[model samples]
Target: MAMALETLSSPIILFFALGLLAALARSEMTVPEAFAKGLAIYLMMAIGLKGGVEMAANPLTGEVIRAFGAGIVLSFALPLVAFAALRLTSGIDRVDAAASAAHYGSISIVTFVAATEVVQATGLMPGGHLVAVAAVMETPAIITALLLARQANAAGGPVAGSERGELLREVMLNASVVVLVGALIVGWIIGPEGFEPTKPFFVAPFQGVLCLFLLDMGLSAGRGLRQGWRQLDVGAITFGLYMPLISAAVAAALCWVLALAPGDSALLITLAASASYIAVPAAMRLALPKAKPAIYLTLSLGVTFPFNLTFGIPLYTAMGQWVGS
Candidate 1:
C-alpha cells in the first residue's frame, strides 16, 4: 500500500480533499458549472490525444490485446459483484442496485487519468492503449447492469423522462467515451509522425491544464457533497469507499492470472476500481429514475471519486506491483 502521507501529500489529491472539506464546511467556493464542464472535456481530449500519439509510437502487441481483453471482461464482471453486494447489504431495491452496480462495472476516465498521474509520479510505465482499455470498459457494465435488472425483474417503470432508446444513447455516446475513443482511433490512423503537428497544443500544457482541471474538480466535489450527501446512509457511504478497493482487488487477481506487466496491471485495476460519475449517473437517471442520485452519484462523485483520487490509486498500483511483478 502507498504510505498514507505520501498519498495525502500529492497535490492533486490534496486539492480534492480541500474541495471536499470546503464543501462540508460550507465555504462557497464554486466553479462555474459550464467552465468545469469545459475543463472536463479539455482534459479528456488531451489525455485521449496524448495516449493515441503514444500508441502510434509503439506498435500494437499481444500485451496490449490482453490488457484490453481484461478491461472488457472486468467491466462486464464487476457489476455482478456490486449487484450481489448492494442487494445483500443495503436497503436499495433491485433497480437501484442494478443501476448502481453498472456504475461500479464501468470505467471512470477521471479516475483512470488520476491513476496515470500517480503512475508517472511513481515512475511506472503503462501502455498508451490502457486508454483504449478504458474506452472498451465503459459500456459493458451498463449492459450487465441492465441484464441483472431484467433477470431480477427490476426494470422500474419508464425511468423519468427517459424514452426507450435514451438509455442507449447516453451509454454509447457519453462525452468522455466518444472523445477518448474517437481521438484514439484518429491518433492510431495518423500514427506518431503524423502526431507531431498537433503536439504543440495537445502535449505541451498537459500538467498545468490538469491542475486547473483538478481545481474545478475540487469545487464540483465540494458542491456535490454539500448538496447530496444527506441521501447516503451509513451502508451506502461505506460501500462507496470500499467498493473500489474490492473491485481493484478483483481486477488485480485477474491481471495476475493473465501475468500482465505491473504497470498495465495497475492501470487495469485502477479502471476497474473507479466508478463512473459522468456517464453512469446520467444513464441511471434515465434508466432507473427512482434510484436516488444522492445515494449513488454522491457515493461515486463525492465519496468514491475523492477516495480514489487521494488514496486508492497509489494503493492499488502498489498492490498490482506486488501481484503482477
Candidate 2:
C-alpha cells in the first residue's frame, strides 16, 4: 500500500497524469514530435549505458544466463498463449490476433525504465544483464507471430516495396535496438571511471527528462484512446487490461523457479507485462500488412501502457518482493 501510494505520488507519475488529463480535457498543449523522438533516444541511451556499466561490475554468472534464457522463452511462448486467449475471448481475426500477440510477447523499454526507478526506490538494484535480455526479447515474438499467422493460413507474401532483408533489418537494426545495444557495449567498455565525465548529462538529469518524456507519452496515449477507443469492443478492452496480469503471473512463476533477486524479478515481470507500441507495431505494419494497426496500437499504447505505468509497476514490484522473500 505504501509502495503504491509512493509510486502514484511520484513526480514522474504525477506529470504523466497531468499530461493525460490535459489531453483528455482537449487542452491545446503539445510536445513537438521531433523533440519527443530525441527524448526517446536519450532515454534509451541512458538506460542502456547504466545497465552496461552495472554489467561491467558484475561477473558473468549462470544466473544471468538463466535470466536471459527466461526472457527469450517468455518472448517466444507468451504470444502463443495470448493468441489463444484473444481468439477464444475476442472477435479479432487470426492475423490481428497474431499481431497483437506479438506485442504482448515483446518488452516495452519505457515501462522497463519506469520500473527501474520504482525498483531502485525500494533499494533493490536490478541486474545490468537484463538490458541485454530486453534486447534479445524484442524480436523472437515477431517470429512466433509470423509463425502463428502462417499456421492459421493467414500468411501473405512480401509487402510491396519491401526488400528481401527488410523485416529482418527492421527487427535487427531498428533505432531502439541499435542505440540500446550500442550504448550497452560502449558502457561496458568504458566502465564507471570512463563514464564519470558524462554523469551530469546522462545520470543527474535522467529523472527529470523521464518526467518530460512520460508526460508526452501520457498525451500520446490519451489522444490515441480518445481517437481509437470506439474501435474496441468490451472484450477487446477487457483483454488489454487482463492480459498483462496473466503475463506477469507467468513471469513471476518463472522468477520463483529461477530464484532471481527481488529487483531483477520485478523488472522481468514488468517487461513481460509490457506491450510494444514501437518495434512490434512497425514490424506488424510490414509483416502483417493486413492486420489492423488501429486495434493493436490503440490497445498497446492506450490501455496496457497506462495501466502498467499507473498501477502495474507497483503490483509487480510487490509480487517480486513476495516471491523473492
Best-performing candidate as measured by TM-score = 2
Count backbone overlaps in model 1.
0
Q: Where is model 1 more than 4 Å wrong at Cα?
A: 1-4, 157-164
Q: Candidate 2, residues 125-167: lDDT per residue as tens digits?
A: 8899989999999999999999999996797776678788888
Instruction: List candidate 2 stretches off by more than 4 Å.
Output: none
Alpha-carbon error at 218 in model 1, in Å? Answer: 2.1
Model 1's alpha-carbon lDDT is 0.82
**Root-mean-square deviation of every model:** 2.0, 1.0
